[model samples]
Structure formats: structure tokens, C-alpha cells
Target: MRRTILSSILVMLAGFAHAQTPECDRLCSRDFMFSLDSGLDVMPLVADGEHANGHMEDGRTPLIWAALDPDDEDAIVFTSTLLFAGGDVFAQDSKRGMTPLHWHLFRVGGPMKEVVAMYLGEGASVISKDNFGYSVLDIVNGVATAELYEVYELPYVNDEVADMIRGWAELEERWKDAFGMHLGRDPTSVRYFEVLAEEGYIPAMYAYASVLEKPKVEGFTPDIEQALYWYEEAASVGEVNSIFHVGSSAYSGTDTIEQNDAMAHEWLSLGARHGDTNSQSLLGLMYANGKGVERDIQKGLMWMIISLRFGEDTPDRVRLIDEMSSALSYQEVKEAEQMAKDCIINFFEHC
Candidate 1:
């Protein structure tokens, strides 16, 4: 095993050595793209100073290429790796003068907010514009519609991407309006949210469903049917919170939602992989108790440890930890802990 591991390391080092150039054009090389798409560590290619920010012939950096493909299964992993390796989030392509964030918004999609948030967190400027004078906010706030697309001579946007951008803007507006109304104690806040939810705004669907599930206001009764409907709706769109709610409800068999351990396992697995701590905790319980799936103590304990690391501690959680810890051998506990650490490092994708 040691020999095999050493051989693998040597092979990777050989490839990395072959890929590097003195001038550092590795970021845009075909080999680099292959490495990124294959989930090989491209960090080696960028580890040398300034290579992470290097551009191609078209003046597009690796980050820009990654941003252009939000739909790719490997995009997020590659994008995050590039960012971690110090890819300049503000790097603008030569032709479009669009930053990574701007290029991200210029695509056709159903909101890549996680990727957008990552760029924003790294200080990507939202006000930055393209050569056509369109800001990131302009595209995302509904200002860059089909009419403006024509006016700006952005023929590359086409009808589909323009419609998607318009939809994104509408969703943003609905989210802001609904949030403001709710905070201001407006009586029609729920109705407003319901309208947005019906329009397929995911956050509104979750909010509306939450209100129906448990009415904090006086004079409103619980509507289990509508709550479950919206919860399921939002979950279908990969809304993490709604996925947790639906999974939890399905596991515990709510008034309207039936008890189906299989459905609970499926949904909670999705939620857990999306980094929902509650989902992780519940999935741990499921694995530990063999509730919906086969029992696996180490897998269960790993998730419990992960949940405790990322979430606030509770009495039930502590007790579960103690119980699971007592049941596992020392080696089992150590392995489980290592698994939890790796799971977190991989952004829960491997978990």
C-alpha cells in the first residue's frame, strides 16, 4: 500500500512538472482543463507564484472559464479550488471587460447564488461593468432585459439567457419585497410571499410553507396541506432548508405528509450533501438506528461529529454523541472523526 501510494505521488509530480511552463500559461492549458474536469488537484499548477492569475490568449483566466459553466458537475469544485489557489476574482476578460462575477451572471441558469456568494465573499465587486456598460447588478436586478440586450448590442446573450436573467431579477425583487413586508409586520405579508412562491421563487416557497406549517401570528391556523406542498415544491428546486423540512417531516410522519423512511433517507441525503447540519444530524440518527437504511456505526458517528462541529450543541445531540462514542472502538472513533474532517473539506460532496 505504501509503495502504491508513493508511486501515485511520483506520477502526479511528473505530470505537474510536465505541465508547468517558465512563463506560466498553465491556467489556460488543455492539460489544466483536463485536470480540473477530472477532479485532479490543479493546485500544483497554480502553486507557483502568479500562475493562478495567469490568462490565456484571449485574456481569459481559469476563473473566468470556470465561471462560464455553472451547469457543469465539476464547475463548483474547480472554481473553489481556483479561488483557494488565489485566482483573482476581479480578473476581467479582455474582449468583454467582464469580471468573473459578471461572466457568472451573463450565463443562462436558474440562479447560481452559492457560486455568486463565494465570489462576493472574496470581494468581487458587484458594481463592476462589462465593455457594454452592464453592471453585475444591472443583469441581476432585471435592468438588462431583451430591449436593453438589443440596445447594448449583446447579441450573444440570446433570448434564453435574457429570459433567465429577467427571471432572476424578478425573484430578487420578490425576495426583498417579501422580506421587508414580513419584517414590518404587514398583515398581507403571507399573501405576498404566497404569490412569489406560486411564481416559483424558492426562498418565498420556503417562507410561505414555514408560515403555513406554524403560524406565529394570531388568527392564522396551520395549513398542513399547503405547507407540505410548498415545502416539496421548494425541495424540488434544491432549496436546502426546504429539503431539511420535508425530510424531517417525512421521517416523523406529519399530519399531511406520510411517513416514508425511504423518502426521508433520499431527501435528507440530498440535504446533508448540501451542508445542512440538521439534515446531517437526522441522517446520523437514521444510520445509527437503521431507521430507513442499513446500520453503519462509523458512518453515523461521522455525520454526528460533523453536525456538532458545524451546528450549535444541544442536549439530545450531546447524548447521542456520548452513546455513539461509547459503542464504537477507539480506532472506529478516530476513523469516523477523520471522515468527518474530510467530508467538511470536500464541502460535503464526498459525504
Candidate 2:
């Protein structure tokens, strides 16, 4: 009878495990991007479930899985997708206090260099202490032996790479100090920004573009195509600043991108919806002048008004608002104001 009861308990446990598979599999799957991009609604995962960041009990996320999965190709794309789809890159393991950055740093070579750089661009800390209170700099510094590299599956890399990996913390520190922890100037540092940008770092894309756009007359000719490519790449991940940059650039056709009003309108509208002040402000003016969209004076004022809430008041903006105010009736202005309120209230979901 006891044997039969044990058998029944085992079957029930197995059934419970099978039943729990769908949600976990959908989220923690190595190819989660494939499923997510294929129409899986991300709301359910982020709504009540903590799957993306995982909890203290698991210390696992799609990024951790993808990073460890030796078979997963183009894991960077998947990682970027996770960030875009609302995965928390800064999520610390409740028990270990380690981050995705720590995990990637624990295995530094091959695609890892760029992957970790992308995380750094996304604001992952390089010096945070773990559960054992050891930072990556403390643990991995001067510890690059053959067995260590082999453990991380980096047999192809040479001994010189040890210096490269060990010295990376200092280089990263210099890169950060060069920019005051931001993306501006000091283009000579962080030569890997383009690689990280290609691996889906929005800021790196913007930074790499800045590096290209910097005024230089020797050794490197600024490629506008490359600049536009990074801008568009950054824009793809809904980086508001990148969206504005791309939209503004697209709107003003130069020797680079031929002016496409429809495309400009589309990109700017996306930027505006995503709550970028520059985009909202530009979209307001665009709608007012019908530059890239149909002339809707009230609609223009609506977005311009929204932009004002987040940005500094400027003379040009004030003058434009005054002009639009004179052009609009009281009722029309009130309606636009209400519409702006509704846009905010809806969290831009229906905006």
C-alpha cells in the first residue's frame, strides 16, 4: 500500500512539473526572442510574473541562460531583444547580489567582450560587490590560466588575451572616466563601442555615431552611411534620444539621407509617443507647419505643450506657442489640452 502511495505521489509530482512547464519554458527559453517576436504577449510575463528578472530562488533570467548556453548563436541579438522587451539588466541576484554583467564577466572572451561592453553601456556596474563581496576586478584580475580559459570554453584565444581580459577592468575604468560616465567626447577610448553597438547597445550606437560624426580631417573619413546606420539601429530599440536623432536627421535631408516626409513623420511620431521631449517638440512644429505631416495646428500645439512639460522653456518655443494660440480658438485649445492629458493618463499605450 505504501509503495502504491509513493507511486501515486511521484506521478502527481511529475504532473505538476509538466503543468508548470509552459510559462517557465516560454520565458526562460534560450530562444525566447523567437517566441516573443512571434506574437507572444509580453504583458503576462511582466504583469504578475517575475520571469524576466527571475527571483532570488532561481537567480536566472533569459540573459543568464543565453549567456551560459554554448549552442545559442547570435545570443547578443536575443539579449538585446530581452532589454527591448523589458528584461531588467540591472537585476541583482537576491542571494548572490551578482548581475548579468557579473555572469558575462565571469566568462570573458569570444562574444563576451562585446556582450559585457553592451551591458556596461546600458549602465551595468563594473565594480559592484557580489555575495562574497568580490568584484570582477578582484576575482579575475591576473588569474587567466589555460585551465581558466578552457573552463569558459575559450581555448582558441592566446595567452596575450589574459592581459587583455585582466586589464579590461582598468580600460573600462578609463573609458568611463574619459566620458564622466556618459557618452560624449574621448572618442579614442572604448574602441569596442562599435562592436558593442552592433551587439545591440543603444548608447553605444549613439556613441559610435558620435565617434563617426566627430570633426576629423585625417586617418578616418566620416561615413554618413555608417552614422545613419547606427542612428537607425539605436532607434530600433526605442531609445528616445536615438529616435529623435534619427527622426530629426531623416526629416532634414542632406547629402546623406534623401528627405522622406512620410518616414520622418513615422519616426518622429514614434519618438513622440515614446515620450521624448525633443521628438515631441519637433513633432509639434512638424504638425504645425505640415512639414512632414498634414497641417493640424491644434495637434501640433498638443505635442508642443507636452514637450514643454519636460523641457526647458525656450524663446522659439514660446513664440511658436503664442502663434499657435492666436491661430486656435479657445474650444480647440481646450480640446487639445484635454487630449494631451488623456495621452499621459493612458501611459502612451493609446497615445
Candidate 3:
């Protein structure tokens, strides 16, 4: 990585440092597109960097390239210039029918909010369909659609993103040392986590967020807002543990985030599908009381029963079940019991 940046620097240095240089005429004429991964500041070469809207070999524009990066603050600044210079937020390349949003959502990398806001606030639609009829949320299996719940979040699973989540889990195992190992710990380990978090790695996002919640190191202040923000990052990518936290924590309310039942339900529903009986228990009661969703005694009873089978039949849960059962007809109780069996059999299939 260092070598590539050094080479690009040398190439850029070889040219005269004027307002605009023909140095790129010979050096960069081969490729008009530049990426954060390119590791070189090409801002000097582009005309005001705003008109630097060149496509790469993959047909991706400069904006698409900039979205994939997490570390290059300059790339984000350059993207702002490109946008002001009449850059289209909705520009799609023929390859995979992707926009810059697609690149940002899928790739690992920094300064995510600045880039996301520029496109979103400029009327970029999260609902835009790709060639495959997949929305941005659908492409990632609806993991990060919490923010988009009003327009709605995608739920269909994407195998590629699932595999990526698995890989992140494995990488996390390797970086366990990065958790609290500061100066007394491995500095490289800490850097690895920070880099990955900045790059939008979900697990790393969660880990880093959790750390910020209550800094393990002395003198570092806790930051719940920062913690929740990162948890959202992890939850957006379908991280199961993150889903649990996103739902439960929001529902319970904390100093970091407000109590939001709707957001809680959305996240908990995702968790329940993943066989989270705790979520099922909450949903069971919520449905009974119409806390976030509409009141449905049948659904409430059904979810409660499912929790029972999952070893969550505590005294309160049992009493709630009994109370609801009393209000239900014998046939209704039987139907809800059957629904629980079916849901458990298929891990909440058709749930």
C-alpha cells in the first residue's frame, strides 16, 4: 500500500506544480478516474478537481471511486467539488447498472456521512433499482435499512453480502487483541481495527462503537451517540449481534438514543427471523399491547409461545401468556400454538 502511494507521489512530483499541469497529460491520460485506493492526491492534476469526472476501466466515475474509500478526506472534498460542478448523483454506469451509492454501500472505507449526505440530500434515491431489480438495501439483504424504514428497508438476503459478513466475523476473531490493547497493548492491533472501522467494516464498526460506549482506557470519555452510530453501521450490514443491540437498546432507551418503538420493531423483526427468541418475546408482548405495531392478540400469543419453546418462559412471560389465553377462544389458542410450532420448525419461516 505504501509503495503504491509512493509511486503515485513520484509520478505526480515529476510534473510542474502549476495551477494545471500537462504532467498528467502523459502520466494520467491513460486513466481519467482516480480512487481513494489509488493512494495519491490527484487533486492537483484535475482542473479544479470538480471537472475531474472521468470513468475508469469498469466505467465507474470519479464519484463512484471516491465512495469506496474510508480514509482519504481529500477524496470526499474532491467529490464535493465534482458535485458542485454539475456531477450527477444518479449517474449509472452500464457495468452492473450501479450508481455511486452502490459503491459506497458495498465497499469498506472513511468519512462515510459526508459522501452519503451529498448524494442523498441532492435527491439520490435509495430506492433506485439496479439491473437485477435490487435496491441498495436489497443488495445487502436489508441490513442497514433502519434509516430508510419510512421508505422501508430491504429484507431479501444477498449471498455475497452474507459471505462478506462471515469473513468480517473471522477477521474480528483475529483482532480480539485490538479491543483494549492500547499502549500496554498491541498498537498495530489497534490500528487494524481503526482502519477497518473507518473503511465501514461492520464488525469493526460494532467493536469500535462498543469501545466508545465506555472507553476501556482511563481518561477517555464515553460517547453513546458515537456508539449507537457505529452499531447502526454494523446493523445495516446484517450483523446478528448488532441487530440485537440495535433493537433492544433503542427500545430500552438510553442517553445515546431516544426510545423509538418503530425503529426497535424493525430491527427486532430482523432479529426474530434469525431465531432470536428474546426478540420474539418482545414482539409477542408488543403485539399484544400495540406498542410499535398494531395490536394482534394472535401474533402476540404466537410469538410468546415461540419464546417458551426457546427456554424463555419466565414468570412474567408465562403470566402474559395465561392472560392472553383467557381472552382467546380455545380455537384461537390452538391456532396460535400451531403458528408457534410452524415458526420454530422453520426458524420463523413465513413469520
Work out the TM-score per prediction: 0.52, 0.49, 0.45
Q: Which candidate has the highest TM-score of all? A: 1
lDDT of each: 0.62, 0.53, 0.55
The RMSD of every model to the true structure, in order and in angstroms, is 11.6, 16.3, 23.3
Angstrom error of the Cα, residue 260, model 1: value is 8.5
Among all candidates shown, the one with the greatest lDDT? 1
Error of 3 at 342 (Å): 3.3
Give a tens-digit lDDT track for model 1, residues 128-232: 577778776676555556454343432244455445555556566666877898887675888888988887666788899998998766668899888878888
How well is each residue in 269-339 modelled by candidate 3, as lDDT tens digits?
87767555566667677787787888998888887665553232345555667888778899998888777
lDDT of 2 by residue, 251-281 (tens): 8865555677787788888887766667777
lDDT over C-alpha atoms for residue 175 of model 3: 53
Model 2 score (lDDT): 0.53
Lowest lDDT block of 10, candidate 3: 1-10
Candidate 2: which pairs clash?
Answer: none
